[model samples]
Target: MIEFVFHTDDVARVRFAFSPLWELVRGLRVLADPSRHALHLPWVHAVRPKLRGLDVGFLRSAVPATDYIPDFLTPPPGTPLPDFAAELEIVRATPPEVVAEELRLTERGGAAGAARRAMAAEPARTLEAVCVQLGRFWSAAVEPYWERIRDLLEGDVLRRTRALAANGAEGVFADLHPAVRWHGGTLFVDRRWDYRGELAGRGLLLVPSVFVWPQVSVMVPPYQPMLSYPPYGVATLWESSPAAPPDALAALIGRRRAELLLALGSPASTTELSRRLNVTPGAISQHLGVLRACGLVTGHRLGRRVLYTRTRAGDALAESPSVQ
Candidate 1:
């Protein structure tokens, strides 16, 4: 069990941010044991062939099926919305000593041990090499789908922020995960090892990750007190095809529009919707404009993008069995 005691100020300071680096690192874990992370099998199947000849051996070893991943590889995001380039630079600048120490703490046996030792012996060189591989891996596996992933993450943050406003931290943590518990003035995370610490006013950083589903990760002091949990709706992240709408409704609204309405079951951006439905962005925009004008959809500006979702009337129309 890991306990983080929080003070009044600590509660106020609690903030949420998502990181590309964290996703990339945790993603390696998924690749290492795809069976354990069945939710990500689609991603695994798509990414494996792209990774051919990419030198991610050390990265794979560092993030074994079940073991301690080096902290230096994944520092807490400096900002709420950090790009991959910035995060990669942070990894590139990690002190050689910190890299070596963290790598030494990972599993030490067989190929894993050998990889760790080699990296530990040449931390600076290893850092550069790792950064290069990470860039290639990100382009191949994550960048292609980042828009969809970011939309889900942003929606999650919006939901949690609303929960925080309405019900305080308890509301956000109450249903965060089965292994997480929040009570009194402390946050508890169930883990194989035992640990306890106080926030001491440093506050807590909440990060929602798409790859860390079915499990939660924590970073205690000596680092920012950060928790990365799977965001809501991750189960649907890799779904390539949207469900077909009822034929009757499709006839009422053009088939494409009906499909678009049904796809708005969750908030999504134009780009994300376009990719998911294989429709051009211009067509999506035109359809969304019509939906917005008709009161069937609403759009909210989040960061640089606008996320659209079904309004109450829209939901009713989509769920109406008698639309015929």
Candidate 2:
């Protein structure tokens, strides 16, 4: 179990941010183990051939079979959200010794080990190559959906932060992950490796990921400590087409309301629904307002965005029989 001891100051310092580089790294996992992360399967299929041409040696080492990932490869996000270029620069500028050490820990031996050794020999040159490949990968696979991804991530943070505010630390930690627990001023994270760290008033960074589902992870130490958890609505992040509304439900509440109900299979912001339906946000809001009034949908404030999701009643309605 990994334990993060927090002080009163540490609790106040907790913050949320997004990592573009981290997404690129986790996207590699989707590539390596497509079966495990089926949510990303479509993305993997689309980008797989393009990836065959890139030098993925560093990724092989950086993201190992085990949950442990090199912290240097994915540095803690800077305050707010670090841009992909800025974060890549941080990785590229990592001290050679730090890079070698992280790679050695995760790679151990085999092709991954060999890749690390090669990188250690000429750190700057090889780091540049790794960065270039990552940049290209991001543009092809991630940039297109970054806006939607960002909305989901930010919404996750908003909901969690509100929980913390309303119900205190216990409320937030309780649902953070099944593997996480809070007791005696320390937060425990269940992991294969053993780790214990003190916040020392530096606080903990909470990041939401679309691809890092089924495993809640933390960056290995000697880097700023942070945890990455699957966000609230990742299951639908890659949904290519909105689900068709049930015919009976469409007849009952108009096609637009039925579509809105089906879309809320996961929490989504007005902007997201608008983009998905190719309608104006105002139109989406009008429908959402009606759904909210009828007790079919609920909304929560996440930062400036309000994400809406189906109420239990709404779910039943969506699943009700279609007109014969």
Candidate 3:
């Protein structure tokens, strides 16, 4: 009854917003404190559904398997893998460039990224593989009413909303820290174990699938890898889950910051957040500049415009009780 309808084009928005939007959700979960995380839901409600669909849909695609990510939703600890539609876990961490380095074909026609392979001979096997991957995501957090979910994922407004979630190009890859890069689409990565390890160095942990498709593997970093994986229990999450960090960075900042924080929860043009908050756009920009300096905010581009959001640190600061 959540009435989560979205325009068909919004799904394209999800594809565009695939990255930043994932970080936003992770940031929200990290800044779990009520006052700090209190993003006016109703205000978000007024956002065009196509745009809202992009936010919601991108998050949906980004969720990791429940077993590896405990807080997400899964069976009890020490329980069998029955909870997962796909039975898998990384028994070993592969090293960097594993995907491109060790490319092997399950069949013909290049790799997973090369486009749909020749599967006419084994249509049933191909169909089975697709089902397994779909089931894996479903078990992770796929909705009961998937058709609606799909519709929400795919919307034109979702595409336009890209400045907030995925398509924004800003500091997206500005890290010396080596990354595996498999998580951002472009597949057939599983053949190379080294690539798997590469992502881990950058904090992305892949949950391997026993039921192999051509090259489908579920990746996990931190519950909030989008904001630069906080170097705490990211490794122990699946191998051994960690008690949620008390110093969860996003859980810290105060009221004014919290309001600004929530206002920027998704990327918003300065004019947008200002208009929403009844403040001048210049005033909003000033606050954002401060937040950015502290590593608590980031910006993205949409044409000549820039959109802003709570950085991982910003979310943490906003959520935390004021130490000051």
Candidate 4:
């Protein structure tokens, strides 16, 4: 068990963030063991053939079977939400010393060792090469689905923030994952190794992940502490079709609008809705505008993007049995 002892100030400092770089790193796990992550199988199958030409050896070596991927390769996100290109640049510029030290931690034998040696001998050149491959890989595999994935992550953060306000840190941690527990001022994680650390004041960053489900993971200290857990509403990613609404509700709002209302059972962005409904963003914007004007859906700006959710009346209308 890994115990994170939080100080009074630490509690106040806890925040949520999303890392494009971290997601790239985690995607390696999905690529390495596609069958193990059945939830991501659809994504894995789609990206597998494209990955055949990419040089992913260094990334694979960094994340050995022990789950001890180096921190330098995947830095904590610079912002609450980071752009993929910006984060990729950060990876490209990782200090040579940091890169060498991290790579040195991997097993010093065979192909893994050879890769590490090449990186250690010329960190700058090797890192640029790796980043080039990552750019290509991200373009092919992750960029297409990032908007939907990002919205789900943001929604999870919003829910957790509300939980924190209503019930405090314990409440927020309680349901984060079954592998995680909060008691007596200590956050305990059921990890393979026994460990303990005091978050003197740096607090923690909670990161929501779609791919890293079933296991809760932490980046040990010396870096800002971060806990990555599966996000809420992950199942929606693989939901190819939205659930049907009552025929009367569909008729009342027009089938497309009703479908959008039912889909807004959770908060989502315009792009997210467009992808889910297989409609154009302009079409979704028009429908959402109408829904907003009718007081059926509400939109709120979160960072640079605005998210929409159903109002109480909207929920009632969508769920009204009389409509059937």
TM-scores, each model vs. reference = 0.88, 0.81, 0.26, 0.86
lDDT of 3: 0.33
Instruction: Provide the overall lDDT of each model, using Cα atoms, as 2-decimal numbers.
Output: 0.86, 0.78, 0.33, 0.80
lDDT of 1 by residue, 214-283 (tens): 7999888878999999997788799887888889889888889999998887778999899889999999
**Pick by TM-score: 2 or 4, better one:** 4
At residue 175, give the lDDT of candidate 2. Answer: 77
Model 4 stretches with alpha carbons more than 4 Å out: 106-114, 246-255, 290-296, 311-324
The candidates, ranked best first by lDDT, are 1, 4, 2, 3
For each predicted model, how many residue pairs clash, with residues at least 3 apart or on different chains?
0, 0, 26, 0
What's the C-alpha lDDT at position 185 in model 1?
82
TM-score comparison, 2 vs 3, better candidate:
2
Best-performing candidate as measured by TM-score: 1
Off by over 4 Å in 2: 65-68, 107-112, 220-222, 242-253, 261-267, 278-282, 285-324
Point out where model 3 deviates above 4 Å: 1-14, 17-255, 321-324
**Model 3, 163-200: lDDT tens per residue?**
32554322222221233131233212222323222222
* RMSD of each candidate relative to the true structure: 3.0, 4.1, 18.4, 3.2
Better of 3 and 4 by TM-score: 4
lDDT of 4 by residue, 79-110 (tens): 66678888888877788888877776643332
